[model samples]
Target chain A: MCGALLVRNPKGGLDRPIALYSTALILLLLANIFPFLTLEIGGRQEITTLFGASQAMYNAGMGELAVVVFLTSILAPALMMTSSLYVLLAVRFRKSLPGVRVLLSWIGHLEPWVMLDVFMLGVLVAFVKLGNMATMYTGNSLYAFMGLIVVFAAASSSFDTHLLWHKLGIPGRKT
Target chain B: MRARDVGLASCHTCGLLLHLPASGHTHCPRCGTPMHMRKPNSLNNTWALLIAAIIAYLPANLYPVMTVISFGKSQSDTIMSGVIYLFAHGDWPLGLIVFIASVLVPLLKMLALLYLLITVQKKSHRRRLQRTRLYRVVELVGRWSMVDIFVVALLAALVNVGAVATIEPGAGAIAFSAVVILTMFAAMNFDPRLIWDYQGEDNG
Candidate 1:
């Protein structure tokens, strides 16, 4: 027999993930729009946005690195957040949208590729490394990016895939 | 007997037992996901991805991962040099963390996956449970190597102080990130159920 494990969502169910995901979406927007970090030294000032870093990498002739940074830090997170919102909202409205199953599967596959939390930690480490070299100021995006990490983690943990499958009318084989 | 031996396979997306169809075009009645006894062409796909990752791993370690320019003097550091710099600077904990996440984790994961691929191909029945656990560990820790890429991105973005001090991503970061992503895909393509497939033959 092919044994399959099924899990039930704890108390509060999908409500927590919905809230966290909504907040994460907002934070992600802010993270993209604003400057990510700023540095000043020897009377020269430089500002870099999230997208700017990727562009800078591309300009520096590291096209592949730019794509990696862009995809993991930007594209993957956006896809995860939006697809999750689409599924969670559809389930909330008691509507099984077309491709809900496909979307859900994409969310599962994209979870690890989304690295906002790791990127946030990277920002911190960069700050520590650059502390003595020059005057460094975190831009608004840094704070937003940090918030996105926490919110994304919370949203993902509380997201009950089993509950979603059930709502989609998938019969669960009880172990 | 293994599940496949009995012509039954479980839906990976949903917990539904599905009978393997003769033509193998079955779909899970419950989840709507296409059902298969094992990931189709798992070994071939994984081997291709693993080879690509191995090729990337060389430049990932050889070239400078990041460049530091301070006071008109620029210095590029490879991944190993960065780790050594951290340790030499008395930041042992962070050094260790970087070392494990960037260097050790990817290396170990590739080796583990290589072992699994070889054993499954050989139909080795030894340590089936342990091999399954090894796959799980490899899948779990594969993403941690992004730590190095993130560090590069963050520093490059934050430390753009012109001639005073600036950080630029080097070719190594690209290759390194490719290794991490490719290995992850390789792990995902590898089906753990294959580990148990050899058990019935051993018993017989």
Candidate 2:
């Protein structure tokens, strides 16, 4: 893990976890942009974006859960992926900063609450239950969400706290 | 066991893990009980949680997790069967996702808990490093087991039906709840401090 730090070589610094996080964050952003579903009921149609679901829930009087869903699914991932990207890129320039420990702890605490995979399950269950009662169209967004999950997991697994310190030439005795 | 050799005085009446002062042991840390090298109920409590988790895991897998009905036709799928259905229907990738998150992850947690409990009980000290890795895995993955439960709860609250298609949780819901609780208890009961303590003993 220490050797995998973003130290300069013949090529520029490219640590595995940093690379994983960048890819995951970009994928998550794309997943957010794409439409998860196109609901067609009684000749009316609306493509449900990830944001749209939260909005709909808020409109339906489940405001608290809506905020939770948004934070856990959207805001938390945004913070995680962005912070991860920041740390990884910073390491390449040997610019390690204080509070990396605190950020990693936050990531650890919030990781499970961000339930993209579970959200996918909710989508499928909605499809199966609404098959005849309502007509639903699957779209590219579903595919994007699937890809997003892999990128997210890879991003999380590749992250190593020790690597950040190592990049700054902080002695490798584990903090 | 020697107070002179280990450098901490013992209270012969009760065995408690206590913080000794610079000179010698002060008092019984817990219940004002005299102190010893080992904690009394830690091992037993961990084993109880582990056993409960293993038992709960069986029903969590075998019983129907969710029941879905469409147009007066109903079908039920347990966690394993759900994954199998996903695979049979050519949703193999999604099948893998459910298989791992809902099924394998929880079981891995149970095993991890068991391993931690046993190793702590036997005082195994070979892999302090690997034990830390396992502990993290168990702690992190513990709540993803709630993924299935969250789906169930959310859908149950969202979709209500009298004659149209409906969704209902099954007996496995209780068992799955137990899996979540038992694993959480297992994580909490297995002391991480024990890992460092045993490793120090091995080196000493």
Candidate 3:
């Protein structure tokens, strides 16, 4: 296990995560606001954003489903990005915020629960399934969601928890 | 003869190993976050969450996950029906993906959690390393079951062409999502340290 730990460190730095996280936040906002997928059939069209989709689910009597979707796709990701920004910014300023370590740990826990990438793949599968039924056009939010996935991935990969712990002056290193 | 027996407890948040204070200090001095020798109430919490998941799993698989209306006709499809529809339409790969991710993953996750909880409660030392790996696998794959819910949300968001076609989420989607999320919590609440507890005595 110690040998595995020694080999686990890949290249990561602070500057890149800050940039990527900022971009991810912007894209996340866009993804939530704008319509993600537009369906046109028989002269009627409907546009839906991420939140709108969850709302639709709730309105259709799947309230728990809506809550799950809303939490995993929107709430978790938003929390992760903002919390990451908070921690990374504190690190950049060379100040140990009272909750910096706690926030970082929360980010580690939140990372897996955020399902933006998988949600995007589901969008694609939905598109293919709906293709024969209606004329579907990809919306701006779809593009933003795609970008959010890439940017969020970049930010998370660039986040080094060990380095952050060291910067925060947490003692008794295992390695 | 656990690590705690040797007076060592690793910080949960920062991975720092420190002597277990005789006074039972709860906060890690290094990180200022609460520390525990093993997760508190691990077995009871896991068992509660697992039972909840098991209850939710029945309705999740039984009811329709979504309803699709097209050209004056409405049809509701259960998760199994959806997978079958995909397979019948020759989209076997997507069908298989959905089957594994939405169905298999959650069921397997619950079973794995149950197994871990049982073994840890019994303090079984056999195959300790493999049991630990299984716990890791359960933790890692727990989130993937969200794929089905995502698909439902996407389809419900899209495919809203009015009379020509519309997709609406069904009650089962919510139930299925509950099962997935509850199982995830169960896995998180589990303490893998318990898997190694019995082994320590033999090794020492």
* Regions of candidate 3 where Cα sits further than 4 Å from its true position: A1-8, A96-98, A170-175, B23-25, B200-203
Clashing residue pairs found in predicted model 3: none
> Predictions ranked by DockQ, top down?
3, 1, 2
What shift in Å separates residue B95 of candidate 1 from its native position after superposition? 1.0
DockQ for each of the predicted structures, in order? 0.49, 0.05, 0.58
How much is the lDDT of residue B194 in candidate 1?
A: 88
Query: How many residue pairs clash in model 1?
Result: 0
Q: Kindly report the fnat of each predicted structure, to 2 decimals.
A: 0.59, 0.03, 0.68
**How high is the lDDT of residue A157 in model 1?**
82
Worst 10 residues of 1 chain A by lDDT: A1-10
Top-scoring candidate (lDDT): 1
**Order by lDDT, highest first:** 1, 3, 2
Per-model TM against the reference: 0.91, 0.53, 0.91
Give per-residue CA lDDT, model 1, range A1-175, as digits (tens).
2333346565677777888899999999999999888887777788889898678777777777888889889999999989998999898887858877789877777888887766765666566666666778888988898888888888888888877876777546532
Query: Of the candidates numbered 1 and 3, which has the greater lDDT value?
Result: 1
lDDT of 3 by residue, B44-128 (tens): 9999999999999999999998999888899999888877877777377887887888878988888888888888878787887
